[model samples]
Target: MSGAFFNSEGISALLQQFDVSKLVELSKKVDLLQVIKNLNSMDDQQLAGLMKVLNAKPKNRELPEIDGDFYDVSHTLTPEQRELQLKVRHFMETEIKPIVNEYWLKDEFPFQIIPKFRELNICGVTYDGYGCPNLPFLMEGVLAMEMARIDSSIATFFGVQSGLSMGSIYICGSEEQKQKWLPQMQKLEKIGAFGLTEPEVGSGAAGGLTTTCKKTDDGWILNGQKKWIGNATFADLIIIWARDLDDNEVKGFIVEKDNPGFAVEKIHGKMALRIVQNGLITLTDCFVTEENRLQNANSFKDTAKVLQMTRAGVAWMATGCARGAYESALDYTRTRKQFGKPIASFQMIQGHLVEMLSNLTAMQTMVFRLSEMQDEGILKDEHASLAKVFCTMRTRDIVSRAREVMGGNGILLEHDVARFVADSEAIYSYEGTKEINSLIVGRSITGFSAFV
Candidate 1:
């Protein structure tokens, strides 16, 4: 017993104990199935002995597959939506997962993924025309979840391009503007970026935008700096927002990339969403012709409309981040062992896992209904803000627990969960900061603006 069983050739002894004489007699008279049946009839010791004699490893009893969808959200999807969701999920797992870490580490956008993304044909999903799918809001939320599950940077990139940039034109663009931009943007032939947040303005963008656009004889001249403009570096067209000097009201401008006065420097050394190429944009007398203006985006209300739509999408993306972390942690727990037992068996470890799952499930359910309300045309600014605040807050917690349960290994990028942890910070702050979103809800409930 003191010696190592492996070194002494334990199989030979166990085989001897099996009584080979009896097996030869039994096998000669029986079919293979009958022999297996006879083996099944043997006692535990006998069966173990036979296993040793056959030099076969004991069959592993696999635990049931861990599902992060604690609630049956998938059950709610229509067959088509579910198929599309799975398709995006599979693409993320196969195409994005392998190369994501490298690109993420380099803080560079993977331009190559565009062709694969176009193949998905999911761009302009949930939009009405211009070669778009016009799908339900639920499908839109599901697609966001699938993308963030593998890579939040890509999800953010898509949200900026599809949700903010394309959505702005879709919602506020005149017929002509939509006709010009939507189809090409939908096909990813021309990438787009949204520029609203400036260096001096973030959560306070609505009322305080200092970026000014002046009316000129020729058209309008835009002059200001926009911070954290995702995809601005290579976008064919940028949706630039500036307060009109005459009316003191915000307006959206479609600034083409080649505009002489438009300059972009990649905002570097970001801790979160590294795969996103956020640019610090300098607009110096950038002249956009009257035709390029978003004809309907006359005031802050128009800009707010665009933010409201995309903010809900961000909430869904936050849920995706949490779900990805929770599922990754769950998978790791089952396979990772300590003291001859899975670490998942420990009470404290199970507690952390459960907490992560509960938050993730709650976020998933909340976002589902938020999208439902959005589809029904009943979604308000406060409604989207509520989900954004709640889901991003809970996502931060869930990802923390996910990393905590993994101990030191959690911080490593290769573990997969770590990236979610980092990306959650960006999601928490981008569309509306947690504080800004909370104030939106607070103002709605209390009938008072707490922003000041």
Candidate 2:
């Protein structure tokens, strides 16, 4: 064949071997005339060399797939639940993973992701009505794990909105309250925060909330301060739990963000979960109408119900934090070389990875059962608290070991394990500290209330 014909045939053959879409994309970037002219100018030897190069596919090293669930705990999920779990995992990996480190470093929440997060349609995962998915508590646990696996701050933010805030309405709010707030909050159109913990009372919030509420003809007057409230700085609604001055019992109120007496100052200088926008809220005579009061929340007992449910989620979050750290460290050790071989090949490194995985798997299985109890309507404060204590404590160990395996990189946020390490501290302390949670379980089994 002539040179021009040979060039034309070679180009046509090469195009045929590749995908049509790829060729179309190439056409959009290059001039067809110029490409053909260059092809035609090449000598026969050069043309043959070019053909060989084009035909060769680059060889890439195939790494083994990382599976954190060594015991296949996910097999317990139903097909639909499993599908939802995978969907949430994909959303976390794609949407939250890229920017989480940046946000964590800056100590800022990524408001830009709210609209994208709404697409997940996962808020209020277990509630029965008001536009919630109403899947199951197990599914909610899975979603929490997935979110925390990438970023615990994001998980805490979601938990505040979906679990603590929306849950108060679902479990304690009146029908009308649920009808109004749950739907909007479930859609992420209105953000919400749970204001139960105060500077004076965190683990003791149920019994020792000094933020008082006074009922008047005008409405309920709320006064006092709430500290460490996640999402308070930007939330549209805050579920404030306060002592009803008349009865000396805790009552829940839905306070609007625009309320004149409600002021939120962002809590800064956090060493952990920095991406979560925690606020120190000063509620100075905040007026909430009787209509906004949670009708079912008559006492501290009612408030405890909300904590019982969300504490389960906190356990799941701890599991996810540990899982993220373990997986990141595992991947690092596998590729990180020492003495011309992956450190993962060393006996000590393998032992560290194994210990991390053991704790992680135990946490995963424990939370799975905890959610199962919630789904069965048999979940108790002790059940939730036990998981919280165990998971958080084990998570601390897992993350420290994770950081240990990665050496210097483990302490750096960019590697992802470092964020898990720092965030685990917050998770350990929040919801309920290890000591408090252990006391809860102690009270349950021993019939002695040791909380003072």
Candidate 3:
């Protein structure tokens, strides 16, 4: 025993078995000579027990499945819908996850992924006809959650194409407009943009859209600047919502990207949603044929209908954003060691994770109900607005807590929480701001208008 495990050679081999820093720590805490003396006094049976302890692998350190759906909200979908949800999830996790950080850092859209994205056949997910699946609004909400759960920029890009562009035509454009664009757009051959938020007007778009359209004898002339228009930089066409000069009411038009006087400048210097390719659209007397006018979009009410629907989808996106951040933080805490144990085992860190899950669960459940109301045709502006307000607000909180749990690593993009933290701000403000959405709900509940 003295020569085998207590000699200089045996000690050298034993020290090699342990980590250097850990050995240094252990030496400082315990008397190494005394430990060796005690080890040498142990009998054969005691030595066997010690060897068994040393050879035993740690109780399988694999973490539990990283699911953020605490309430089983996804199980509410049918088997078919659930399958599709997972398909998109797999695609995003495998394809987009690998390249997202690079493109996000460079502020470039990955054109290479577009072909794979088209393979999903999920664009215009809830819209009927023209090669659309015509699934229920609930399924659309789930898909939105799954997309955003990985990255919100891709979700926003999809939302602009599927919800805003196709929805405007499906809800307001003539049948001819639907036939011409929905098929190609659904196939993702022709990308689309939604231009409603303008350089000066966002929350006041309903009442004060400075982008104006004057009806020409042969066509309509659109003139104004649209800010934060997603996909505007490369879209085949953009659904421009401008106030009609003649009627003084908001109207929607399918403004082809190549149409004369249509120019788009890619917006830069963004801190969030960098991969979305948001464009500042300049419609310098841009002309749209009579056929291009969304025939049924005669008033702001029609535009509001599209917003109401997409806003619900935005609420689902908020849940996905929160879930993504929470999952990343949770995974980090489980493996990140501090004080000689996984930080996730600490009470404070566990509390933070629970809080994040609580907010995320609430968000998921709220959007689930919101989408149901939409499918049942009972959705209103206030209902959608209420969801957007609540979900985005909660998402902000979840992401904040997620960042908190990660310590200094929270701000790093490689961990994924930092991206969620920044992208959340953009979601909180777009579609509708928190203050505006709250007022919409307030107006409905209190029987008083709160618009300034």
User: In model 2, which regions exceed 4 Å deviation?
Assistant: 1-63
Candidate 3 lDDT tens digits, 1-452: 53256877888888889999997898999998899988888888888899899999889777789899988988878889989988999999999999999999999999999999999999988877899999999988898989899999999999999999999999998989899989999999999999999888988888999999999889999999999999999999999999999999988999887799999999999999999999999999888999999999988889988888899999999999999999999989999999999999999999999988998888888889999998999998999998899999999999999999998999999999999999999999999889999999999999999888
Q: Best candidate per lDDT, number?
A: 3
> In terms of TM-score, which candidate is stronger, 1 or 2?
1
Report the lDDT of model 2 for residue 436: 90
lDDT of 3: 0.92
Model 2 TM = 0.86
Give me the runs in candidate 3 sitting further than 4 Å from their true place: 1-29, 32-58
- Tens digit of lDDT per residue, candidate 2, span 1-452? 33656465777886788889887898999997787778777887888999999999999868778989999999989898888889989988998899888888999999999999999899998888788887989999999999899999999999999999999999999899999999999889999999998998887787788999999997899999999999999999999999989999999999999987999999999999999999999999888899999999999899888888899999999999999999999999998999999898999999999999999999999999989989899998899999999999999999999999999878887789988888999999998889998999999999999988
- Sorting all predicted structures by lDDT, with the top scorer first, yields 3, 2, 1
> Candidate 2 has which clashing residue pairs, if any?
none
Model 3 steric clash pairs: none
RMSD of each: 8.1, 11.6, 4.7
Off by over 4 Å in 1: 1-59
Taking the candidates one at a time, how many backbone clashes does each contain? 0, 0, 0
lDDT for each of the candidates? 0.89, 0.91, 0.92
* The best candidate in terms of TM-score: 3
User: Each candidate's TM vs. the true structure?
Assistant: 0.88, 0.86, 0.90
